[model samples]
Target chain A: MILIEGKDITLGYEGQGIISGLSFSVEDGDYLCIVGENGSGKSTFVKTVLGLVEPLKGTISYRGGLKKNEIGYLPQQSGIQRDFPSSVLEVVLSGCLNRRKRLFGYTADEKKKALLELERLGMNRERNASFQELSGGQQQRVLLARALMATEKLIFLDEPVTGLDPKTSSELYEIVDELNRGGITIMMVTHDIHPALNDARTILHLSQGRYFFGSKEEYFRSDLGRMFMKEAGHDHH
Target chain B: MIITEILSYPFLVRALLVGILVSVSASLLGVSLVLRRFSMIGDGLSHVGFGALGVAAFLSLPPMAVTVPVVIAAAVVLLHLSSRRKGGGDSAIALISSSALAIGVIAVSAAGVNTDLNAFLFGSILSVSRSDAVVSLLISAVTLFSYSVFYHQIYATTFDPAFATATGIKTERYTALLSLLTALVIVVGMRILGSLLISSLIIFPSAVAMKLGKSYLSVSLIAAAESLIAFVLGFVSSYVFSLPTGASIVLVHLIIFALSVCLRHSIIVFRSHREMI
Candidate 1:
């Protein structure tokens, strides 16, 4: 089943063309990694696919009975997030916002689900802790918990492991892999070409003026993927 | 006895009621404003309110009627600039704020000496009429109601706007609504703390509370409590010492902010020491 498909998509901001005529599709439970360098339109493409950014031109249709709230997103950390005053539980609860219709607060079931999501991410102990006080890895886990609360089918992660220590990022990668194995389509975007990222079953390698989206094996067979692979040096996980 | 004597005055009672209501709303809005780095927008809107008041005064029209719409518009502009920002958000506010202040001063001077001029600049809570109190009460009630109704959405927007946007929350609309509420709160609060000192209500309480409180809800409640405390203490002290009500309230906030900082330092030190043991 096609979960997300974009046809002839053009992504940009304020008349500046970032990626033009890019088309891609994701199947149910597929693990896709978007790899590119800086200015390669990777993040923009992911944001557009997630309906965060308005594509300069494209039709991104979500199919296979996916509701808006069923698609989770873990965005890149921003500077403002460093000092934002919030509780971990509150941050996670916000993920259920679209699922919420009551003006008062989250429903009992939603609150319970949010707690469960935190526990799943190993952040239940920090649920009441101040979000700003958490370490980098802990914050990411809390956000992952948040994204989990938002979706049960698909998750869009924009550099979930950036700015983390190697151990922490690897742990996060394992968790993401587990999530993918559990039948959730994962769209992970990263700038660097790392060994762990190679776990992606599909690689969408974006570069200036061109992009390649295909099976992981085919990506390695392609010249663009081979050049990137040679540059990153194939090695052990 | 002095408290009773002060409370006996219906005008003072009206001022007190209005002050408490406005403080609660202002401080609640303050938490998000300060966290989102738009604290100065409160001050900016206050200047716009002042300028609107001057224009109203010059035209011999009611001030609130003129100030509310103009300040709200200014807030939208500030938020728009901040959204598309390349670091010019602050400067845009500064430019608009200073110009509005200048316009207000000039308009007030040109309009001939009106008794409302001093009140507009530094605030004169004593002059709050029965109708003015009622209007302020309604506006404050509206602000509080809206804040509570959109509490989670506001929290989501301020904490992570991109995440909020992606989740189908109309973050831009909430951002505008936030600024709109801040504008109304400012207009209503200017009478209590004056246009010049009103922004302290929006910036100080949240700044102090965020350090001491553990969670978002705690911080909001603490900020509200702190602002209300400052307003009441400043009101009573202003009566006793013959000080300006706005200045008295600001001074109390300043003291509270300073004390909280010192207490927070000790708490941090104590916690770290215990952790080591």
Candidate 2:
């Protein structure tokens, strides 16, 4: 089923449209990676999908319209976000903030769920540690764990492995693959083309308000893919 | 020695109570401001509070009555302008903060109300009235209650605004509400801490607490405790030594911040040495 459908959307901030006349759809259990150069509206598209920025001229329909407590998300990490004074546990528990009882605090079951999510991500030992003290890879995993606390399905990750070492990135991708196997649809925005080409079933190449969305094999065979490969100095295989 | 004597006085007790109330609320709001990188907005709003005080004095109205609404109005305008700007949130805050401070100073000067600039510049904790204490208490209670109730949403919004919106949290409403609450705290705190020193009361304690505390809740609580201690000590020091209450309070808070920084560095060094061994 189509979980998210954006039709001919145009989005931007304060009347300046960044991307226009774009359309896309995502189904349940699909792992789609959006790739483009910097300033190519990759992040903007992610924001639009997340409803952070309203589309100026089109409709974005959610099949099972997202619930207030559903839809886990991992935003792009930046230096500023790293210094936020929160523990790993507290950050993860925030996923369940919407679910907490109004007058009462976080219930035992909610705390258990947060802990369980952290454990699943192999961050149980670091739950008590400050978020800033963690390494970049560890921070990303903790954020992922936090997102997981909300729901197991329809996770939107913005550049999940942007600055990590190869080993850590591979491990993180393996975790993404694991989540996908568990029936979680993942929509990730990324710049690196190689690893994603290898892992993602679908690749959506966006640029200047235009996009080429297709299966990975079809993308590699398309004219835009050929142009991208030539520009990046990769031989067409 | 002086602490006991200061505690014995009813007015001093009232000052301390007012300080505690404002400190807690400001500390809570400080977390959001620091995270958002709009810490200077506190300073700007406090200056607006000073201008409002001037207006109040001129009109023979209670300073808080005028200050609260005016500061809140200024905050709303600032929030709106920042949202509409393309220079990003912190830059927008900086732009509005400086302009507001300049206008506020001008307004105060133009009013020519014979109010001591030092009282507004530095805080005069000893002068807190019964009504000021009551207002401070009410603001603190409301701030804490609302914060606790909306803790999750606020946390999510602060940490990742985009993700928070995706999760169906109304980021705009909460952001505006936070700005409004911050304005209220600034106005209420202005009576004891004064306009010039109030922002430091909001910021320094939180910075120190963030360095020491393990969690957000712990950090906020520790900040409140530290601010309370600083307020009492500052009040006492002022009473005994005749020092400026605002400067003394700020100094105590800064001392705590310096101590926390030193402690953090020492721990890092010790950990590194242990790792090497």
Q: What is the C-alpha RMSD of each candidate to the true structure, in Å?
A: 1.9, 2.9
Tens digits of per-residue lDDT, candidate 1, B50-157, equal 999888888889888899899989999998887776868999999999999999888888899654677888998988889889999998899889988999999999
CA deviation > 4 Å runs, candidate 1: A14-17, A195-197, A235-237
How well is each residue in B1-277 modelled by candidate 2, as lDDT tens digits? 6667767889988888778878878888888877776677788788778777766665668676777888999888766665564747566656666665666566567768576667876767777888778878888999989988887778778888766777777888899889999999998887777787899978988899888887777887888888888877776777778888888888888888899999989988999999999
lDDT of 1 by residue, A1-237 (tens): 999888998878787887788889999999998988888888788678767777888788889988654679898986336877788999999998987778797899998998998888888899899999999999998988888888898999888887899998888888888888888889888766663245688888888878898998888778888778777876323
lDDT of each: 0.87, 0.80
List-wise, what DockQ does each model earn?
A: 0.69, 0.54
Write model 2 residue lDDT over A76-146, tens digit each, in one string.
Answer: 88623767788888888877665556554678888898899888889999989988889988988888887
True lDDT of residue B244, candidate 1: 93
Taking all chains together, each candidate's TM-score versus the true structure is 0.96, 0.90
State how far residue B119 of model 1 sits from its true place (Å): 1.8
Largest DockQ belongs to which candidate?
A: 1
Native contact fraction, candidates in order: 0.71, 0.66
